[model samples]
Target: MITGASSGIGRVAAMQLAERGWDVAVVGRNPGRTRDVAAAVSGTAFVADYNSLAEVRALATALLERYPRIDVLANNAGGLVGRRGRSVDGHEQTLQHNHLAPFLLTNLLLPRLVASDARVVNTASLANRGGTIRLDNLDGTGRAYLGGFPAYCNAKLATVLFTRELAKRSPVTAYSFHPGFVSTSFGHNSAFVRWGLSLLASRQISAEQGAQPLVQLASVDSLGAASGTYFDGLYPNGATARRAQDDNLAAQLWDTTARLVGLTDG
Candidate 1:
């Protein structure tokens, strides 16, 4: 299953997986676009708004009920909503859409994923290096912040923490990835960022290029040996921050996230 699979890197990855004879589940908010993308790959399309936890939960239930097992879960449905905003649940929009939604869905689907030896891949980012996780201010309230990218980075950092902690708790392998600076719609909301990225044409790669490593990570047997590792591009080996690998921090993040998302191990 791949979230944000209607376009960009997720879409490319979905096509690649389908070509390899995997039954792909493409997820996105736009039904028409998702259906078109799914048709191109002969995969199923699911539409769900990540901004709504209720919708996310409903989608997860439907997916688990419909599919016997999910061999892979790619939590790639995330973004920065430009200015500061709040979800229907009263949490920051980015935190809710980018982190909390995926967090909840992954946990709800864990049993099915585990039953299938599923590998989970989270689309993390280089932006993570610029931000810090404020446990006390998980909602990004009570603080004057910059624009979108910093908050986006914080969400990605949280993803890595979540992946690491999840790896510790289960036999299922989980990894975070920096898909490189690909030219995608992800930065289109910011004119300056978009222009800058455009200027760096030589540096930015296509979504197909970015998706290569993600597909390799999900399908390759060698990656099975390393759980909770961060991948840069297609290389299984890369330098992740020491803080990202902190078990103590990862555990704290797990507990806090579980509470925030209302998922206790009952």
Candidate 2:
């Protein structure tokens, strides 16, 4: 199952996996495009807007009902912004969509994931270098945002932390990987970030290239033995920042996230 499979890296990755005879399920926020992608890959389509936590729950229930066993759950649906916003659940939009939404969905599908011994892949970012992880401010409710870059970084950092936490708490393998600066609609919502991303066009990678690590992490037999490791490309040699190295912080974030999402026994 791949979230954000309607376009970009998710689309490419789903198509590639489908070609390998995997029964891919494409999850997207856009119905038409999602159906288009699913049709292209001969896979199923699921639509859910991560901006609403209720929709995330609905998505979880639907996935569970349809797929009795999910072999791979890729939490690839995310975005960046130049401004701070809130979701239907009233949390910081970036935090909610990029981190919280996937977090909740994973927990909801835990029983199925464990039963199948699934691999959970997260599309993280190198921008997580200076990202902050504050136990007192998980949603950035009390902080001020100069721009969305910091918020995006924080969310990505949270993704890596959550990967580690999940690996420790569950039997399934979980990994967070940075796809480099892939040229996509990731920051199209912000004129400033869009222009900034355009300036780096010379350095950005294609969506197919960006999806390579995800494909490797999802299907490669070697990676099956590894869990909670962060990958930048073909290898797990890349490193995260100081804050991301905190086990205590990961534990706190996991507990806080469980409480926020109303999970009974997180």
Candidate 3:
């Protein structure tokens, strides 16, 4: 299952996976492009705007109904929205959409994932290198607007931290990777972001190239036991920071996230 599969790295990865005869599920916010991707890949398509928790829950239920076993849950639907905004769920836009929404969706589907002994590939980024996250107050508005790419970095950092946290308790394998600065519509909402990305076009790779690690992480038989690892593209990279390695912080973040998403039974 690939969220953000409507375009860029997600779409290319889905196509490649389909060509390899793997069952693919294309998910995205755009109805037209998602449908196109599903048709092109001959896979099922699910549409859920990440801006709404209700939609995320519904999407999870739909996926559970259609797919008895989800071998992979790629948390790939996220981007840096330039200006500060709130999601339909009332959380900050980038934090909620990029981090919290996926957090909720994955938990909602955790049972299916565990039943299948799934591999979860979180599309993380180097944006996390210098991020400052308020793990105690994950839904706090302050962290949501962590300034510029800091917001994105914090969310990406959370992605990595979540992987580490999940692996500690779940048998499911988890991996997070930086899909090398692939040229995508990630920050198309902001001209400033586009301009900044263009400056790095010399170092940027294609979306297909960026998707390689996700494909490998998903399909590699050798990595079936590989959990709580971060990759610099396809190769193993060091942790984002010492803070990301903080088990206490990770646990707190998980608890906070659970509470935010209404998972109170824990």
lDDT of each: 0.85, 0.89, 0.86
Give the TM-score comparing model 2 with the true structure, all chains together: 0.95
* Model 1 vs. true fold: TM: 0.94
Clash pairs, candidate 3, are none
Single out the weakest 10-residue window by summed lDDT for candidate 3.
139-148
Q: Highest TM-score among the candidates is held by which one?
A: 2
Structural similarity to truth (TM-score) of each candidate? 0.94, 0.95, 0.94
* Candidate 3 local lDDT, 1-266, one digit each (tens): 99999999999999999999988999999999999999999999999999999999999999999999999999989988888778887787788877898999999999999999998999888887866668555554554342346678788888888999999979998989999889877787776778878899899888989999989988888853458998988788655866788889888888888877777764
Clash pairs, model 1 backbone: none
Candidate 3 wrongly placed segments (more than 4 Å): 136-147
State the displacement of the C-alpha of residue 124, model 3, in Å, after optimal TM-score superposition: 0.5
Q: Give a tens-digit lDDT track for model 2, residues 117-140.
A: 899999998878869988778777
Q: How well is each residue in 95-121 modelled by candidate 1, as lDDT tens digits?
A: 888889999999999999999998999
